[model samples]
Target chain A: MNNEMKLSFSSYSSNESFARATVAAFVAQLDPTIEELSDLKTAVSEAVTNCIVHAYRDAIGMVYITASISKDRRITVKIRDKGCGIPDIAKAMEPLFSTGGEERAGLGFSVMESFTDSLRVRSKVGQGTTIIMHKKLAGRLSGFAR
Target chain B: MGVRFVLKDDHLTAILSGEIDHHAASGMREEIDRKAGQAKPKLLTLDFSQVTFMDSSGIGLIMGRYRLMQALRGSLTVLDLSQQMKRVVNLSGVGQLVPLENSRPPRKPKASAKSKPKETIPETVEQEPPQPEEESRDIYSHSEWENQEKKEVMVHE
Candidate 1:
């Protein structure tokens, strides 16, 4: 079974929870464990937060998310933003290297990378940034089978 | 999300409830800092027992508060974190700077423990056992704070 979803929301901090919740709801059909679901939500939250805080900065823009699940239970999520793109993806992805002032822990990319099986970042200066992540769910029996 | 502050003697605990994200965290941070700064407690405890969901932003909240407490010469501890929250806290290495209540081992009898001092013990060890009467009285005396918390909850809702 293969399914996918696409969502676009304003780059407001309030929408961070909405984006992650929507992705979690969409992926619920895959019968993921509680831990798996939590990992996905955290990853999605981090990505959406990056878009709201770094990508759009002071202005409000749109953040795009596309999530899909494959027959083998591998889940892929792509989050994109159309705002100020990252000047250097490598430095941005480094742990504890935040441009955001004191409040930010600078662990967003690290959290996203650890939560998901694999993470890929693509960005072009003055364009935008895209974060793509993949995680394989444990093959648990469907609810009907139990 | 809202935070309810409880002050007893020189200890302060912030009971945090609801989903904590980047959006809600800024408010919580300010509130906690304001109260902690005013109270100047020797120990600050962040109570997450009621928190339903948290993300990396939660780590930032804890880290920021830890720094605040440090600057004020007070230590901070995070208590009642769910298993999932514990995992996130551990991953961020925030546990090294701030202590987590649930992750601690059960305390041994003082008589037996006195035989050997453990070097691995964290420097910010708990100060003293809580006194129930003093806590209750403090809450009763600080009715204004309760009212403030109620207003905060209403606004968040």
Candidate 2:
């Protein structure tokens, strides 16, 4: 569970999917069930998408994703981006609320919240935003540290 | 994105191939509406078999089709979805409207759904035969057009 891999890519919409797939493949060796894998991928996509759409504000930036499976059988993912930080996490997390128009459904945070067991966001205005999500994988936990 | 149509006895199957995003939605809408109307199918199936990728715009496309089918009293089904496509479709709640069916052979292309328009069907005739093309202006044209206009606005911005 201690294995950590990082990737740097432009804050493009297409890259969001790549980030999710990359993280999913990296953690697939942990023997997660098909459903678990799907959930993790969905969660990752949402997080990365948020970084691309909201944090980056249509500007070029790098998104760093780290995945680790803790001894407690918890799979942790942290998506960090050095872009526009969330000034009001509470309002941003509201369902059906989005800064963008109809193109953005504002459901990204809701999807992330529903998919993962534990979700947290740490951000500071004018700095950047970081999202951490955790899911409890069944069976033995990996012996990896974050 | 390319949309191929196959008309069976009473089903008009539209196989959506390639990526379905905002960029490809206008063509997809027109194609699906034309084929569905022409076939006059009792069941419309949107085969996602060859669809390599999809985004929220794809979800919008499916939802639009679902509404059209409902108005026609026809069932809509999806098939041949990648695991990622399945995840996105399921999350969007379209899975509930048109649940995925078991894999089946492609439908016959010659037997179109247009043969028995509801108005012409004989009384007590539930299943009608295939017919020729019946061109009808798409009812969703305005909405689809608005979407395109919005896209243009975004592009110009």
Candidate 3:
């Protein structure tokens, strides 16, 4: 299960859904259940959204996404943005702590955390931010890598 | 960003589908509010059973509906939620303001979910419903206004 695909797009809010749909299609080769695929799309949506709303706040930048199916049928996604970085990862990951004001529910990280098997974030104040999330598909493998 | 409005007995149910994000949420908030305002239903219900995914923007959409219902002195209830959506709505404290009906087990999806309505409903609900030509006030939130300003400044800078 070494199938991998990556794409980069502008950090516009409109592209959030596009990123989700594209990644879901790329990962469909794993034959994930409907719910599983939906969750993965939702998680990816949150990650890309964070990059657009929080990371690039009030501006536009480049957002890169990479999806890979590992040996254990786990789908891993990494969403990164070259914009403002989060200062506190722990605080940001809280269930209802959003820095985007009333417009934001602040559950971006929590949503990703809930939908995926594991959520990891690495960021620096003046550099950029990246979110890595992985989820194992439920059904048997479709063998896209080999 | 597909929406279908079901106007039942004194209740208006807005069934939202597809991926719900900030861009989609903005359009939904405006259109739903307008329709609900005109209908003035005794109970304004938001049906999320068809919604596959939503983000923080969803919370804002529901919260906006709650505020509009309050202004109208009408009750608001959210119904037919998937487990994932229920988590989002409850976590945002919207549950406290509006009673969320139908927990909706993982399977056995509800018949009322209405993934896509017939030709009776518009595809996107983009057109603003006819109004009495009231004073056009700034409709965007503070953050939205700030975003517009920032976009302009960034372009010039």
Candidate 2 collision pairs: A1-A144, A2-A144, B39-B113, B39-B114, B115-B130, B115-B131
* Pick by lDDT: 1 or 2, better one: 1
Best by lDDT: 1
lDDT of 1 at A102: 79
lDDT, model 2, position B134: 21
In candidate 1, what are the lDDT values of residues B31-142, reduced to their tens digit?
A: 9989997999999999998898888789899999998988999899999787678777777789988888853432333222343355466544433333221222122236
Q: Model 3, A1-146: lDDT tens per residue? A: 37789999998888888899999888776656556777887788888888887788878889999989876788889888888898888998887787776767777877787789998899999799988888987644224342
Tell me each candidate's i-RMS in Å: 9.8, 12.7, 12.5
Q: Indicate which candidate wins on DockQ.
A: 1
Residue-level lDDT of model 1, residues A1-146, one tens digit each, is 46789999899898988999999988877656567889999999999999998999989999999999887788999999988999988899888899888788898998898899999999987789999999998654332111
Off by over 4 Å in 1: A143-146, B103-157
Considering summed lDDT, which 10 consecutive residues are worst modelled in model 3 chain B? Answer: B129-138
Q: Note the Cα lDDT for every prediction shown.
A: 0.82, 0.70, 0.76
Question: Order of candidates by DockQ, top first?
Answer: 1, 3, 2
Candidate 3: chain B TM-score equals 0.64
Q: What is the overall TM-score of model 2 with all chains considered together?
A: 0.59
For candidate 3, what is the DockQ-based docking class?
incorrect
Each model: TM-score of chain B? 0.64, 0.63, 0.64
- Candidate 1, after superposition: displacement of residue B65 in Å? 1.0
Docking class of 1: acceptable
Fraction of native contacts (fnat) of each candidate: 0.63, 0.02, 0.54
